[model samples]
Target chain A: MVENRPFLSFLTHLVLIVGVVIVVFPVYLAFVASTHGNGDFLSGLVPLLPGPNLIENYRLMLTEGISTAGAPPLWIMLGNSLVIAIIIAVGKIAISLLSAYAIVFFKFPFRLLAFWIIFITLMLPVEVRIIPTFKVVADLGLLNSYVGLTLPLIASATATFLFRQFFLTIPDELMEAARVDGAGPLKFFRDILLPLSRTNIAALFVILFIYGWVQYLWPLLVTTDSRYYTVVMGIKRLAATADGEPQWHLVMAAVMLAMLPPVLVVIFMQRLFVKGLVETEK
Target chain B: MATINLVDLKKNYGSVPAVKGINLSVKDGELIVLVGPSGCGKSTLLRMVAGLESVTSGRIEIAGRDVVKAEPAERDIAMVFQNYALYPHMTVRQNLEYGLKNRGTPREEIDRRVKEAADILEIGPMLDRKPRQLSGGQRQRVAMGRAIVREPAAFLFDEPLSNLDAKLRVQMRVEIRKLQRRLKTTSLYVTHDQLEAMTLADRLVVMNNGLVEQLGTPTEVYDRPATLFVAGFIGSPPMNLLSLESIAGAPGFEGLNLPDGTDVIGIRPDQLVLDQPTGQNLALAASVELLEPIGGESHLHVRLTGSNQAVILSVPGRPDIAEGAAVTLYARPADLHPFNRESGRRTDTAVANP
Candidate 1:
């Protein structure tokens, strides 16, 4: 009977493969378009295979000395993305781990209530809080600064919640053993609990890095000056049809730059992310 | 080596009391084991002594210093957990050295103690291997190494050998006892296995429902359990306890002044005799129900001819008897214990020779 279900099975695989292609094909197309000049891209000549002008195209994209009004240098924006992604990734993971450890292991009054309140933030969308959050940042003198861009995005509900769940799965007896080994709360956390949570931290690092890297609206609204723009924000500002029709090649180049860090993070830390989810079940 | 004293130690989680107020003391170089069924607070009491659990109202003294308010480190205690809790990322040598390193022990001393512990545990060759790479017994040895390197005031073990296989548990039990004796360190070990308690404890503190039922040498606890719970809880196949209507009535005889209105007769299967002359002792007439031969020993299960309850006699070798045979068995009066059925208390009585 399973063998006879040929059409259904074939259609299922076809639908799945087509869905994957649809999601990934846009990025592939952007890479192809970035390889060519604006005219070739406008003519809908999609490059199926590698072409010969790779160096020339890269030189044209990097031509910042000509005082081109629109395009930011691809490498510079890529570097900026790495900085922001690294800062936010490291900051978010550290804060989330500390917050999660406090909530999970510490003995304090109203801890459960605090955990619930922090968890409730996950239910509210960023759009609803964006206006007030921006006003608060502006009042705090953080606008157009790295602090403004990162502070709003660094302390995440998802990371804390994910890590808290992960911490709970650690056997309490192990913590007790650490305590008996002469480790105080800080020492226990540093020497024992924190080291054991590597897979979770690695997984959360990739997750938070991606979340910060892909952020468009928050960074766009926070940094009014283009000099402080993130890679994602830079991509949007460059791709806009403000002066005339959109510069598709420049936009694709910036978008491609903005997408690089996240792709690399996923590729490098895929095992950690998969391992984290597997351990969370345990 | 140190002495530990627990005075009225109690622990409560919300409304449920996990460990009722308990008092205990350990002399220097003594191995006291807290043993009970699950949820009986044996582990909780042990944790309290280690300062891992907050004392509701008590005074815990380690080597004559009050440690109730002190951190576990301040109390100078080392513990082996049920799961062994060897740092999964660290090798046996690293796991053993971590506590000393954190305490700022000199490198030479740390190395000396780690090597000494590895040699003591016979795990010297496996020192560089991580916990995940080792077997359960190996991890258990590493846990022991960690504790031994501390040379703390008292060593606390919370069901440390429970995770191993039965044969391994028995073997480790002997190793632990030998190690403790050689080191002469005061230790408090907790386990639910009565056999572990009986064999390893210099003195056993048997608890039930958060209360200490009996505390004494293993032989004392076994031969003269102060409470019915202790009598019933220990021993394999447990003690056979039968309810008797009166200590001075038809069930009672010249040899036993089974107190008037007594309700239970506690008899050890080994103490039960198969052959009794017509006028030798209290005859418990019964029909043979089953005979189970477990190697050199034969367990004869018998149902009293006129009674619903059956009695079991564990004897050496097989008896020339088949099932369904009617027989009268007798036991010396000294071999029985009469307990207050209402309170489950073992009532005292002088044994009389028949």
Candidate 2:
């Protein structure tokens, strides 16, 4: 831009185009495959263009699903995913906000120890502690339930840390001002601190919603009941039928459905998400 | 309005004392300004009064009631912060209404106070705008409006205008003084700016190193600074403090009778004259080092003829004085303040030979 080098600009465009193609190619292929008939994938490398059986594949997946594989209908799985995503997003925000507030504002014994304990959990992802976590959930009789799918995933160190960082950047004088305004601690937290955190909460919701939705291994581990299966894990069952070559058309259709809600969320709330992400991390 | 008293208020952070024992009685409806350079504990004292900081070893009483153990809210005081601390999410109306609402004021009363405050601040048109939408000066007004609506027993201002531009700062300073006079609220304002303190305060409490160096009206402190710290800290171009030993042999001291332990002399730059007068008690020959013409007055930086100790003299308009030129400066005996170097206290009992 500084020198106005046409060649460099052309090179930049070429590189961006290549990057975009690489990212978009797979989703395009999945859509193409979802539009095809059953025989297309069996004879050749999946279809590259729109097929005439698009409505049939999507309708079958949404209404009856591939029942032979023990997967529930797409609508039921999608609904489960929706419920799990919302609960995890809202739950993580609530707990993290309260914890972050306490950690940042109050002076209590063992506060640093508490913060470090929460911070240590960041190093331990769900995959690392999956087995023990599953046993605990099963022992609590939360297995095959929505709580089983979401609660374990709700204790997020990232979201807590984000809120803590955001809270720290707020001027100390604001707190003093609130105190002088006759607001007690809870009142200050509710009236001043919470409203100020709106953007951060929304931003974290988008990321956490996606995080809760795309969970495959955790849901696969806990929910043996078909009714509790989320679309993300249910797509695996649709793809791995017991006795035949997998139904590529329906599986691809289910995959498209599973990715849509979160993708739309990120797109629609793009501005707030970017702002929240940048500010909280700062 | 009510009198606020701080009796031997002290604060320490892990054995490091930030505010040493300080005692002051702020009269009802008086605008007291706590002023010093940064780290002077003026803010700490203000915060203690506001119940935002804990007092280590003394008491803060508001309206004759001991509030040492009370929360900030329970203390019944309002504060305007240095940054204006307006809630970014709330409209000006909401910000003003927030405090009264929390206190469970009746809806009609809240609206009445909010309207009155908005009218007083002349922010009526901006009541629906967020703080971020307002300018710095407007935000400052909203901050004050928030305090005004509370109608607390006292108002605590923590360097509220320090963040504005120079022009706006002066404007807000005048407006704040006018507003305080009209409201007659017991206010404790803090600032590191001496000019703001001098202009806005009914009485000024000048602080240094966590101690009150001087507490008096602006004129009293300026005319008779209690110590070397107050003498140097309160004035612009600061008072010229020269050790008496440096000019002990000067001609003007031939018939002078001074206090026994007097070692330092403070002379205001404005009091130093270019021409020797008939009744002036002190005269010294100085070599001009530099001249700074600041609009209507010129500051002549000069060194004593026999010593390297430099002193400044403020003369009206541009003077026909050049750098390195020898000029005789005179001061009346009454204008020269002598102090003991060890105690830094003015040796006011000094009697000069008549």
Candidate 3:
């Protein structure tokens, strides 16, 4: 039995080691292509290790790569993304928490209808509504701005659905207790309900941040001017070359940079996400 | 402290009526328990009063204020939940002080109320601990402390002890009764456990299928139940109700020979006796079907002579009879409850003396 146990673990370790390499190789390729010159990238000599050309590539990227179409600098785009993302994540989650709280904790007219309507939105993919959404954004004259990018994404259906499920599991007595404590709706949301749902918030934050960052088509349509291009949009155009050629290396570099925030957030946020799900079980 | 009043309270979920039209008045310093079986809408009614639920169509008043339209917060009431809903993130001290702080009460007064509640609940040592860190009983204490610190006009409890184990439920029952008495707060408690209702309530409201079957003091409801539903519902081992037509007073059976038209006879098992000296008295001969030894008492499942039907009798530790053995039993007519079988209403009768 002891021998079998040791053999089983050794086999498990071998499988995981191979699995991680397969998953990480594409990311490693992106990081490697970022440091190499355009020539080395064209020749397809994969940079397996760190290169000394980091500074030269970054300088070129800032001077010409990002400023090609009058778009903001790389750092400016990062800052804009940070602002947009913070607003989108916080706004969407606030709307989600409020709606879920009402549906789960309070009884009112047309509650079931509200629930069904919100749930039905999840049935139709956003891609299906892209044309209609684009027309609405154009009519609102929100083109080429941060508002255009973050507004529609701010009304979340998935987060609200998830949070409502979580809130239902919260005993009705807790809500009653909060009411008895003289906590109004806003006070209850701030003092009791929101504090209790820290884990769910953490989970939703990561989920929403990634969802907002990886957005391409909507941002592409909304921000018609290149000056307002999000990082993802910048990457899409970099590789969409004519004359039977594309900039694979620079495009990968921008993709790698755009991927950084969500990676960092997931690392920091996964702990609370797991903790929140665990707390719900209690 | 203030009284709670419900005028024509009605609650409907879609077309299914939960609490049909009912009126109730809870006086100040009174503890009224709503007792019923599952699906009886007691909890729904309580939530409506708390404003956690809409009235559907009704009026509620607390302290002579028209609170039907008032916010739960504006109503100035407190509630204890069955699951002991202590804020999981907050320490016992913060949980107890949260309301006072939100209400803009003086900081020093908040501390005083928190301290008093902590002392009363004996949770002073655990004030800094989060609710997740406390045991079930301790968490229950903190939930109560959170409400107690509020000092609201009235308190509402929703099956607060139902989550505890049997022994803990009994212990918490007494503890809650003592706590409510000390506070002298008008309280409305809901539970499906009739034992809890009987022991804890100053006045008990018995509900069944969204209707008030009877509302009276525990003794009044127990002794003179207004309906067969009450007689069948409000006791430990519920009262035995056998129709008078189901039996004939044959050879050994000399049971109560009431008028031929009597439909149902209700008798609590303990009121029945064995070895009757007067054959003419209320007595019957029955074959013992099953004998259950329940520690200090034995429950006999007996089949009366000349009848194929059964009746359960709760007697002392042991009765001198084997399971299949036939024996004569005696009971007083004062212990008998005659009910109009079709309507399930009580027939006029005399009460039994202990």
Candidate 4:
């Protein structure tokens, strides 16, 4: 911008173009595979061009699915994914918001100790505690239920920290003003704090929804009942048939379906997501 | 609307005292301005009165009721903050109505109060707009409007205009003064700016280092500052404080009877005359060091000829004086403020004879 550097600008554009292509190449290949017949992949390296069997592959996957793999229809898996993602996103936001509000506004014994304990949980991901978490869920008889799938993942340290940081940035005077305005604590949280946190909640929702949707290990570990299988984890069952040969067309179709909702969410809420992400970090 | 009494109010953050015991009575419907530099605890005192900060000890009474254990809302006070603190997501109308609604005011009552506040603040057109959409001054009006709609027992302003531009600050200062006069609301306003303090306060409480240095009418504090700190802090260009030894041998002080412990004397820059006038009791020969011509007046900085101490004199228009030129400055007996050097307390009696 400072100088009229045409060559440098050209080089910059070229690098970005290369980056975009590298990132989009795999999705493009999957889309191409989804549009082909199963026979096209048997000939050797999967066909690069579109085939006439696109509609049939997707329709078959969505309605009847691959019966041999014991996987339900694509629509059913997509519905389950949607429900689990919504619950996880909403639940995490609600819990994190309340905890963050309490930490920022109230004085209690061992307050910092409580905050530190929550912060320390960031070091232990679900993968590390998966076995114990599963045992607890099974003990509670919550396996195969929506609550079991979402509740275990709802206590997000990152989300709570983000909310806490955002709450700290709110001018202390605002709270004072609310207090002087005759608003009790719950009323202030409801009428002022929640409305102010709209963008943050939305942004966290996008991130958490994607997080819930892409869950493979936890859902696989818990949901033996196909009724609760998420589309993200269900695609694995569809791909790894008992014969060892994956139905390349149908698997690719399921993959595309599994990736669509989250991708759409990110694309549509991009502005709020970016704003929320940057502000929460601040 | 109500009187506020702070009875030995104190606050401590752990072991560090923010506001040492402060006792002051704000008369009914009086606007009391607490003026001090940052860290002087003026704001801390105000917050304690507003119930925003807890009192480490003592009591705060509004309308003769003890509010030491009460919530801020229960204290019946409204505060306008430095940052305005207008809810960013709410419309100006909604911001004004939020408190009334929370208190379960009827729909018609809320509407009437909101309209009255909007009319007074001249923000009727922007009531539907969010805070971010309005200009800074408009947002400030909305903040005031929010406080106005509450019709509480008192109003507390914590450096509310400190964030505005100089022109807007002056404008808002006049408007706030006019509004308080019309509403007859007991108010406690805080600011570090002495000019704002002097102009807006019915009575000014000058604070320093977590204590009240002096409290009086603006004219009283300016004309008779009780302590060296008040004298130095309250005036523009500040009162020129000089050691008694520096002026011991200067002209016109040969036979003056002075107090024994009087070591420092303060002179207002405007009262230091360049010409020898009738009834002038003190005169000092000094050489000019600098002349700052600010529009209609000039500030002449001069050093005493026999000593290195510098003093400033405010003269009308530009004086025909050059740097390094010898000048004689005069002051009457009443203009000289005498104080004890050790304790920084005023030592001069009410009467001074030359």
Candidate 5:
């Protein structure tokens, strides 16, 4: 990158093009597969180009679904995924922002102890605490519900720690000025702190939203009802149909649909996400 | 406008005392500047007065109302911080309007006050711009505008001009002085810059090590510093304190009579002259070590030939004196400030001036 050598430039672009193809080829194949009819794979090879059954396959999957797979329609699953992802993202951000605010600003007995406890939870991801968490949710009769899908995943130590670090960078003089300006603690948090954290929240929301969207293991464990099935779990069901060969076209269509929301979120919030992660506005 | 009274104000961080018990009164509409080096507790004292820092043991009365237990907002005071601390996300108008809005000032009143402050600080054009969009001086004005819109009983400035460049600092200092005078607001300004303290203060409080070294009009403090600390801290190049042992047995030592226990004598740099003396004066033969010609005046660093003591002479314009040249420096008796080494008090006064 530093030199103007012609051979180096060609080598650099060659390396980049190869890397791009390696990453993008699978997604391209999935799109090509989704556009084909059920009979197209009779030759035991995936067709690499567009097919005539694109709309019909997507419509069938979104509406009636693959009935032989015994899974709910793709539309219902997509809606459920959207709701859970949104709730989880928003809930994580809200809780993280408040917890970070309290940890950074207030001084009370065992303040650092509380922060350390939250920090320690970073080691205990959902998988590590799954059994106990499941037990609690079952006892509360939250199975097959949206709350069950989102609540256990909502308390994010990483996001809280990120926000805490960000808040610490904010000048103490600002708080003093706000206090002198007659703003109470809550008012200051809302007016000054929240606005200042816009980019960070955007960045975290994109991450957390995708985290919620692709959730497979926990949602599979929590939800028995087809009413609560997510697009991710639904995709798995479509591919692993109990009887006969799986419909590759319909499965590929579902996979494409499942990847859409997270991809769109990243695209839309990319600028803010990069800014939040890389820069400190204050 | 209101008067501010600090009754034995004290602050302690655990066992370490930041502000020792001290009492002072700020009269209505007076601009009292607290000047000190870093960690002298001037900022702490001001914060305590603003109710930003808790008082260890003392009373604070703003407008004759005790406010030691009051929240910073309830104290009804506004402070301009050293970094300006303007809200980066908010427009300049919102920054100015925040305090008034929080106090529940009606929309019309807030607008009017914001408008007036913008006019006074000449920041009207910047009202819609965020703090980051403005230059340092413009942000500083917005900060002042914030305080002005508060309509608080008093203003506390914590080294507000320290972030500005030297030229802008002088300009802002003048504007702050002018604004304080025009508004007739009781103000407390804190800075370590002695020149700033001298120019802006209605009365100056020179602090050292959590206690007041001297409190007087700038001229009074400049003319006669109460203690050794004030004598050194309040001057540009600082007053030179020559020990008696250094100047004893010199040419002029035999004729002059200093007070008892006068172990040290303080003399302003400008008081030491090159011209031949006409009055009772101490004349020391010296050789120039260095000559610093700083524009209209020059500092002549000289060492006395008798005892090899270094003394600075402030001379008008630049003379033809070269380094290592022999010169005779003179100080009259009246200009000699006698001090006791152990007590650190002026020997000329019977009792300490408080």
Candidate 6:
């Protein structure tokens, strides 16, 4: 941005354009393929432009779905994905806010030990303990339910640590003043701490929502019923055909549908999300 | 209104004592300023009185009721912190009303008190603004208004004006003094600025190193400092402490009576005059090092001719004196404060407190 020479400016724009094409071209191809008829993809090269059957291809995926792939219609999977994502985001924020509050404010015995236990969980994400987590969910009879879909991934150490670090930067005098104002710990958390953490909650909600949205392995393992199959698992089911080549048009349509919510969420909360991540002056 | 009595109060952080054993009595409607340098435990003492800090061992009585075990809210005292700890998320009106709402005050009463505080502080215009939107002085007013709306038994101010600019600090200092007088509430204020301590305090509790060095009215502490610490800590340019051995041969020491074991003699800067005064006086021959003219008065930094010990003379106006010029400075014997090396307390009287 500082250099304004003609050659440097031209080089800068050239590099940026190339990078944008590298990243966006695949998504562009998915959109292009989603617009085409099923057999048109077998013509060897993906169409560079929109085709004649864009609405028809999307409608078929939404209503009739690919029965050959054994996945449910797109609408039901999207609904399930939305529900799980929303629940995980809300549940993680609530639990993490309280846990971080306790860890930072209270002086109970083994306080650091408790915090470290939560922090150490960062090293062992769902992927590392997928088998045991699935076994526990199965033993609890929570399979094929929304609880099974969201609960294992709900205890987020990263969000808890983030909230804890943010909470620590708040001046202690605010708490002292609140206590002098006759606010108990719970009242202080609700009245003072909660409102102050609004942006952070929004930021973490976007992240945790996307995290829940893209989950594949755990949801795939827990839910045997199609009712509980999230869009992520449904998309994988749609792509891995048992008998022949997968329908590239239907799969790309499902891919575009699955990518919509998170993209919209990021777009809507983008300002607050970035502010919560970088702005620490408050 | 209430009287605060601290009976042998102490606070120990691990093994290090922040506020060692101390006793202080703040009468109803008396504004007692605890003045000391940093790490002197003045703020710790104020916090202890506010019940924000747990008492290591002692009794704190407010209005004749024991409150060492009580919560800060239960103690019925409000504190204005140094940072003006206004709730950032709350509007000024909301910040003023928060305490009353928490205490479940009647809605009309809260409104009435907040309005009164706003009127008094002249912050009515800023009622809807957040702390970040207001200027530093406005925020300070809000901080005071927050305490005033509480209608508490006592107010504790922890260096509330230290965060302001110099001009604003002087303005707020005067305003705080006027406000305290009008409210007539028992208050404990802590600050490291000696000038602020001298100006605002009805009674000054000069402290040093976790202990009260002297406790009296501002003029009383200034005129007769109980210890060398009070002597040095309370003044602007600070009292000059000349070793008795170094000034033994000086002209002024001939008529000065002996106080046995009085090795250090403290003299006020203003007391050292260039012209000889009547009555018994100690004349020290010295050469000027620097002349600092601070508008109405000038501080002449001089070094003793023989021993080369530095002494400051506060003259009334800009004197036509050049640096390195030999001048004989005279100080009356009565103005001298005698202190022993070992005790660090005044040797002129058995009891340092008058």
**lDDT-sorted candidate list, best first:** 6, 5, 4, 2, 3, 1
Against the true structure, candidate 4 reaches a TM-score of 0.94
Docking class of 4: medium
lDDT score for candidate 5 against the true structure = 0.91
Better of 1 and 5 by lDDT: 5
TM-score of chain B of 3: 0.94
Error of 6 at A53 (Å): 1.6
lDDT of 5 at B4: 96
Sliding window of 10 residues with minimal summed lDDT for model 4 chain B: B345-354
With a 3 Å backbone cut-off (N, CA, C), the pairs that clash in candidate 3 are none
- The DockQ-based CAPRI class assigned to model 5 is high
After TM-score superposition, the amount by which residue B286's alpha carbon in candidate 2 deviates from its true location, in angstroms, is: 1.7
DockQ of each: 0.51, 0.62, 0.54, 0.61, 0.90, 0.72
Output the number of the lDDT-best candidate.
6
Find the 10 residues in a row with the least total lDDT in model 5 chain B: B345-354
Query: RMSDs, each prediction?
Result: 3.3, 2.4, 3.9, 2.5, 1.7, 1.7
Report the CAPRI category for model 2: medium
Instruction: In model 4, state the lDDT of residue B79.
Output: 90
Q: Rank the candidates by TM-score, best first.
A: 5, 6, 2, 4, 1, 3
Q: Write the per-residue lDDT of candidate 6 for residues A1-282, one digit (tens) a residue.
A: 386699988998999999999999999999998998879878788789988888998999999888888888999999999999999999999999999999999899999999999999999999999999888999999999998888899998999999999999999899999999999999999999999999899999999999999998888899899878899889989989998788998899999999999999999999999988887535
Question: Which candidate has the highest DockQ of all?
Answer: 5
lDDT of 2 by residue, A161-270 (tens): 98898899988888888887788889889988998898888898898899888998999999899999999999889878889899898899999999899999999989
Q: Candidate 6 regions off by >4 Å? A: A1-3, B350-354
| Higher-ranked by lDDT: 1 or 2 | 2
Off by more than 4 A, model 1: A1-24, A41-53, A65-71, A242-244, A279-282, B14-18, B246-252, B259-263, B277-279, B349-354
Interface RMSD of each: 2.6, 3.0, 2.1, 3.0, 0.7, 1.2
**True lDDT of residue B201, candidate 3:** 99
Error of 6 at A182 (Å): 0.9
Tens-digit lDDT string for candidate 6 (B173-237): 99999999999999999999999999999999988889989999999899999898999888979
Instruction: List, residue by residue over A1-282, the lDDT tens digit for candidate 5.
Output: 389899999999999999999999999999999999988887898788999999999999999887777788899999999999999999999999999999999998899999999999999999999999999999999999999999999998999999999999999999999998888899999999999999999999999999999899999999999999999988988999787788898899999999999999999999999998888777
- Report, for candidate 5, the interface RMSD: 0.7
Model 2 over residues B1-354: C-alpha lDDT tens digits? 999998998999888999999999999999999999999899999989988888899989899999999988888888999888888888899999988888899999999998998888899999999888889999999999999999989999999998999999999999999999999999999999999999999999999888999899998889889889999999999999989977687767755676678899899999999877776368888899999999999999999987789999899999988789988888887788888889988887422325
